[model samples]
Target: MEWYDKKTYIEVYPPKEFSFYECIAFLSRSSQEVLHQIKDGSIYKLLKIEDSLVLCRIRYEENAIKVDFPDRQPEKEGCSLVAKFIWEWFDLEADLKEFYQLASNDGILKGIAKSYSGLRIMCIPDLFEALVWAVLGQQINLTFAYTLKKRFVERFGESLMFAGETYWVFPTYEKIASLQVDDLRELQFTVRKAEYIIGIAEEMVSGNLSKEKLLQKRDFNEVKKSLVSIRGIGDWTANYVMMKCLHDTSSLPIADVGLHNALKNILGLERKPSIEEIKEYAANWSGWEAYATFYLWRSLYDEAI
Candidate 1:
């Protein structure tokens, strides 16, 4: 409802405690997506709303974020939707007081949390995009996963040129659902992965799987159960979607390698902890497991955990 003027740029007021640079640091880790850019203390991305694509350039100033559309300004309704998307993408509504206070008491989390203050769990807001990301990252390392995504997006996703740069939008489920395994196999995606991705895309396009439907579940366990029922989606993938897309603060991907490595590095263990050990350690973060996982992952890059 704020910043409704279509003739001018839309401005969003983040929480006073928010840090755009910290969030930019997190986002800048991977530049292969072709959809996002973090440079010169500003963030840029192409967002597809309904049928039209809009390019958004966001810069932080004082206590607010300035959002500008260089090519075309969206209608008031579209502007509102984009504003909400940005808010949710950064988890902007969160008040980290309780999480920070709890972290202060945690031996491992205390230092990591303090070092990465104002770092929220940045999320992939689209359900389809999030699910596809989970499926892509499934048996691969982060670097290879980015390679596959870059190829996939460049090949299938729509693009627009602006100022000698090409910006892309993640391919819609409709486009993916119509493809055969061979179509993706040509792009280096394993046959099994292609099937799994197409299956999930078909589900989303057919009205069977959706963020709105998933959110109807009563609790995290219900959401996890529903997601894991799909092909190629396991407990880890389900928890990932819940935390990153559904905004479940307590979601934990206990089997994530990044999480394991972060824990192993921070705890000074000779080997990665067993699932049982992870469970024991998880008791310290009952209600804030997602934030703990995020900060711990950040430790891998920032080395402050």
Candidate 2:
């Protein structure tokens, strides 16, 4: 991998309340350059995939914002978009004052924010792609999911070379939508995953799954219900995709195995919580269930460390 250095300055349209360091940490979790080592409270490890190591940090001073990615210099046109990406990922502009007030009134929100800082529920704004990835990851180890995604991206995604290295874009629905199930299976996807991806693609291409329309609804539960109505998407997959990709703050994957295990361990329960138990436990989270899940996941890894 090749490495480049760049500095970016962004104007914060609305003043943000979260710590700059926390924002960087949250953004880094979503960056392809950093692999979040959850075994230890979500410490980021720079993976030397090809040859480059990317590290990012942020500095906030009154009206000006400074973002530094030491190892990779961003292309000129991408700078503004990158800044927006970080801001959106951290939800830096969200009105946190209201949430804080609510947290003071509710013990669960206070405990959750104090413990994990609302670091989860960062959505990538690409619902179709996120849904496909979530379905591919179901009931399987994350390593395998990454491997499959890598292959899929390399095969179907467009590539751009910057600073003497190559980066691939996530495959577009139009591209993957054209692929046959056999083509996906050749890339090591299971029959179920292939079918699910194809189904999602068909829906997207046929205009049944409209990202614009989904965002317009603004009701998390309604979007989730719509997603699960698709043939291959279940509860876990729907909630996970909505939380991560749609940035649905209210969505929670109560049936997720990792979440269940993490909650059991953190709350000192004897065994993993059942889906019903998890739902009841998370009820207090209300509008912040996705953040609650993030805290539980952090606690899970932190406990191991």
Candidate 3:
């Protein structure tokens, strides 16, 4: 991520193929989103950099992402952290050329990839957020998933009121680590999910699970295995975390409902694909399964799975 600190703000330059519009379309899909607010085509997010809670106004302009702090700037290191956050949030480091080339001849992704050429995987930079989201979305529809997320964030997250609306920061594991299962269940979380969330937070607090640790195990299989070893994370969730949080390009959630629906619609199948069928279709995807799944998910909607 190439960036420059301009005293009051920092500017990030993305690759030529990066499409801010497409990412915005995906971000705008859920009106219930609380962690970030999109208004007037600019995204406002609250991030806690070390000790300072920084509010940044992010917009793509002139092929660079302009991040402006509404109140005041932080230390130089904080500026770089914010830039890195934005970089990972957009998954800007990925070379899409390889993925595009692989999709060009595929039976499933050729057209879908072209249709959403510039759309990057809207990644969740926080490991906890990504893992919790996967849990919340299990066996639920996207709208309800967003509903759950909004409720959860509003209940436990921090916020700052700007203009008229509020900008939220996702709840910190440090905060949630002190919570009990009953607390989350009161917010409409299932008992299982509440336990999983609390347990995951506790694991992080105990230094048992951290994104840094996962990144150290660069082997895709090793990372996936480590994630799946966690009580709440299954193969689907592990693959999801790998793709969204660890930035593993080969991770694929073949059982994802959105992927199945997208494939059914794209292939004109009367019914959704079986697990075996999806594997057969995905065989050639190899190292680009994450991108392929993302583009296919885009075909279902601008929802940005």
Candidate 4:
């Protein structure tokens, strides 16, 4: 097992009340009994309380991340900054007004927004990790992708134990880079996924890809272009990462199977639309494409239920 630590401080606006468990529920990647896992003391565990910041440790199967707190309690003055980090990491506090407006303009999107109000964009600071995950998820069901990820993480990640539970941190680029394609395949990843993951790691290690620089770019298209320059990263994978990890509001994944199916069902089309058809349909969404995509995904989820 291995241990890693980081300090996170949240500023509450108007001195809003906070429930630590609520925050954990909002931040978890998986929805299947995630809240129950936290309550059962298997996933996230509170470590210490300090002033306005509450310190905690997040436990996975074999890894742990330590979260430290600030010296003072939250207040209105620091709320936006605190909210930004919290939402970026776990909470969804972006310009909901804009999202609502976009949703209201479309019937399908409106229903999605109403049905899944808690859904929010996620941001991962590690570009390599995001890219690799996207690669692993391609052309496969999310359940299978998650299973592969859980196994890969447990096998390769560093872990730590606090109280009685364990926490895991995603494996570093260096750790994954050292592995061969066969090693990843043994962990349940397809050969294509293994190659893509390693290709991304090698490029990052060799200084061919710089996530920081990409984030600094003002134009989202430029960032997407740069990301796709790496081998095995196509339009869908690149746009997905840009929206989820880079927080680009304009990034829309039109090629996703879920998105296609959702649009087909919502529009009452005779068949699933092609990628070109989805792009043409999304022309009206423009600046709010990410929200549109989110709503489409939600629509699909609602249909499944």
Candidates 1 and 2 compared: the better one by lDDT is 1
lDDT of 1 by residue, 127-208 (tens): 9989989999998888889998988999999987876778899999999999999999988899988999999999998898
Backbone clash numbers for all candidates listed: 0, 3, 0, 11
Q: Cα RMSD for candidate 2?
A: 6.0
**Residue range 172-287, candidate 3, lDDT tens digits:** 89899999889988888899989988989989999989999988884988888888888889999999988998888899998898899889888999999999999998899988
Residue range 187-258, candidate 2, lDDT tens digits: 999888998998898899999897777777758778877888998899888888777766666778887777
Q: What is the lDDT ranking, best to worst?
A: 1, 3, 2, 4
Per-prediction TM-score: 0.95, 0.75, 0.94, 0.75
Question: Stretches of candidate 1 above 4 Å error?
Answer: 1-7, 303-305
User: In terms of TM-score, which candidate is strongest?
Assistant: 1
Q: Show pairs that collide, candidate 3.
A: none
**Candidate 1 CA-lDDT value:** 0.87
lDDT, candidate 3, at 202:
89
lDDT, candidate 4, at 283: 80
Scored by lDDT, model 4 comes in at: 0.64
